[model samples]
Target: MQIAYLMNTYPVTSATFIRREIAALEAQGVSVRRFAVRPWDQQLVDDADRQEQTRTTYLLAPGGLRLVLLTMAESLRNPRGFWRAAKTAWTLYRNAGRGALVRHVAYLMEAVHLKRLANGCTHVHAHFSTNTAAVALLCARLGGPGYSFTAHGPDEFLDPGAASLGLKLQMARFAVAITEFARVQLALAGGMGIWPKLHVVRCGVDVTDLRPAPPPATDAPFVCVGRLCVQKAQEHIVAALADLHQTHPQARVILIGDGDTRPAITAAIARHGLGEHVELRGWADNAAVKDALSGARALLLPSFAEGLPIVIMEAHALGRPVISTYIAGIPELVDQQTGWLVPAGDVPALAAAMRACMDTPPEELASMGAMARARVEAAHDVTRNATDLKALFSRYV
Candidate 1:
């Protein structure tokens, strides 16, 4: 069967899980077309993402005039479908703020273009319950294939009404939530009656490709893999590392992603005198990330919010423990048995967890890594999740 995958931005360095999902479906003999609102504006460090860029069709890449022309042509060809899509866009504009009326109009234009681009696909699956999903919804209204979206929340749930998340959920053929917490939030927004349409589909990793490495040494540094954003709370990690420095003078952290908060985090590192202890390695390719995880004692991600970070699964797949916060779906995967789970934004608790991980025996850490790997095998295998997703799509196709 042929299907389409859509996202606001495709081939992003941090969102490798989406690529893996599409690859897995292709391996199962499905013809999957890639679509995106736009290409990632920054330089893509990963070779895989660079390759994926060539395969994606960007709605906005051809410029605004092309979108306008497509909207006009599609309206001339199918006025009824165009009106239906426009009415849906108007509802979304009303549900969201009136200030975003232009954005909603742009979504309708994008949907018109995408409908032509994805002519033969049996279904269209979008990655986030945001603008990408809005375009998908409008496309379906314009006589396109059935559409579904995976909700990875924190932003989507923050203001569901403004996001038009409830409307999207109700209109989608089926909606996927990466975690049970996310599914509950979707239910809350869409109301309890739409619960039957919501399904929990965890983001997954390639278990076989991420073979476990030898156990890390006692003096190994902690590796945190994610964007340096406010939600990721990398600043808290810097503060915690400062506190741990007195007890574990040789301790160090290697942050492996870049974002807007880099200057703030840099300032925090300097202010805390953690220039040597906290290192910002910026964005690394998948190989570098795996190497960093392989050499680390534990993965540190004291995020204030998350939708079960795939890096946690990757760290476990590489036989490394994780020291993350107990927020979102993290508590479901991490505990004392796997690694440390500290409270979000609690610098003291985070510092204590880091210290404890540093002080833990190597054998005990290895045992925790074993359990973590087992957890990934059971719940976060990319192949298995893709099969499940294909089954869901098959029902509609």
Candidate 2:
């Protein structure tokens, strides 16, 4: 069966899980038409993502005039559908905060274009219950394909009204959550009546592609893989390192992602005299990330909010334990056995976990890494999870 996959942006550096999921679906004989609101203008680290860029059609690529023309054409072709979709967009705009009118209008135009593009697809599925979902919802109202979306939090949970989460869920044929925690949040946002529409389909990593590597020495530097953002709380990692450095000066940490928080993290590293102990490696491709994880003692991500990071699974697949927080779906996968679990924003607790990683014996660490690998193989195999998604799509189609 043919399907349309929509997103706000495609072929990005951090969202490789989506790429993997699409690839797995294609391998199972599903034809996927990729659509995005816009293309990633930044450098993509992975060649797979680069290839995906060629396959994705950007609805906004034609700019304002083209979108206006398409909207006009769509309205003339299906005046009734256009009117219905326009009303939905108006409702969304009224529900949103100040300055959201322009955004909703753009979503309306994008939906008009998507309605033309996704004509024959059985259904459309979007990642993130944000603008992509908004556009998808509007497109369905425009008599396009029925659409569903996957909600990843805690951004979605932070402000459901701004995202129009309830309305999106109410209109969607089915909704997917990356974790059970995320599913619960979707149910809360969409109301209990829509609970039957919510399903848990985890973002997964390919275990075969990311096979376990030899465990690193206990004293090896830790690696953190994620965007350097406020939600990731990477600055807290620097603070914890500073505290850890007071006792273990030889300890080292490598941060393997990049974002707006680089300046703050860099300043903190300098302020704490941790230039030698902390290295901001910026963005690395998938191969480089796996290599970095292979050599690291463990993965560290003290995120203030998350919907289960794919990096944690990647590290676990590589037989490396994680040092993360007890937030969202993390505790479901990571605990004392997998790696260290510290309270978010607690610099002292983070420092203690860092110390624990430093002092843990190599054999014990390997044992923990083995358990981590087992957990990932059991719960996060990409092919298996994709099959579950395929089943859901089949039921709808």
Candidate 3:
């Protein structure tokens, strides 16, 4: 089967799971074509990502005028399909407000481009229920292949109406939820009529490639891997580390990603006198992330919201425990045996968890790490999840 994968930005550091998903499908003898709405900035760091940029087609890379011309030519070729897509865009505009209307127009143009490029693909699957899915929905309306999308929550669920997620669900051949919590949220937002089409497919990790490394000899420093953004709550980690310093004077944190919050996080570290305690290592490639996890005491992510962070599974696959917030789909993966789950935004609670991890016996921590790895092997294996996804796509294809 041939599938076209649509993404707003390809090869983004934060969404490596998407790349893995595509690779897993191809491994199972499925042909996949990648399409990105816009070219990612020069910030592309990973070698794999650079290679992907060469292979994937970018819709807006040729500039706005070219897209406008393409849309016009496409409309001239198939006026009925163009009218159907334009009518859908107008409906989205009326419901989602003026700003969304402008965005949907851009999505409409991209949809036209996608329809032209998506040759021999049996289905179009988008990774998120955001702009890329918007384009996917319109592409289908403009006589493209049947489309489906995976909705990773926190953002889409935050304002489903604003994003017109319900309409997208109504139009899609199927909708995928990464977690049960996300499935429930999609049901609520999209209504029960769309429930039959919703399926729970957990985001997964390639455990074989991430075999457990020997734990660090000492639990002095921890590692946190994700974008340095507000939702990640890295600031809370900084605060917690400050509190831990009062007891564990040698406590340190290696932040493995970078974003808009870097300056603020740096300020927080300095303000809390954690200049030496918290080190922002900036963005690292996947191999570098695994290497960092190999040497770290545990993975720390105090996100206020999430859709079962793939990093948690990665940490588990690497035989490292995680200390993360208990919000969204996190509790399903993290537990008393695998790792600690504290309430989001609770600095005191997070600090206590950090202290407990630091104080735990090495043998006990190793046991927990073992259980963590076993959990991922059983539940979040990428190859297995890909098989499930392929089965789902086969039904429509």
Candidate 3 or 1, higher lDDT: 1
TM-score of each: 0.98, 0.98, 0.98
Instruction: Check candidate 2 and list the clashing pairs.
Output: none
- For candidate 2, the per-residue lDDT at 101 reads 88
Query: Where in model 1 is the C-alpha error above 4 Å?
Result: none
Write down the worst ten-residue block by lDDT for model 2: 211-220
Ranking of models by TM-score:
1, 2, 3
Model 3 ranges with Cα > 4 A deviation: none
Report the C-alpha lDDT of model 1 over 230-261, residue by residue, as the tens digit: 99999998989999998999999999999989
Q: For model 1, what is the C-alpha lDDT against the true structure?
A: 0.92
Cα-lDDT of candidate 2: 0.92
Q: Candidate 1, which ten residues in sequence have the lowest lDDT sum?
A: 388-397
Assess the local accuracy of residue 70 in candidate 1 as a C-alpha lDDT between 0 and 100. Answer: 86
| TM-score, cand. 2 vs. native | 0.98
RMSD of every prediction: 1.0, 1.1, 1.2
- The TM-score between candidate 1 and the true structure equals 0.98
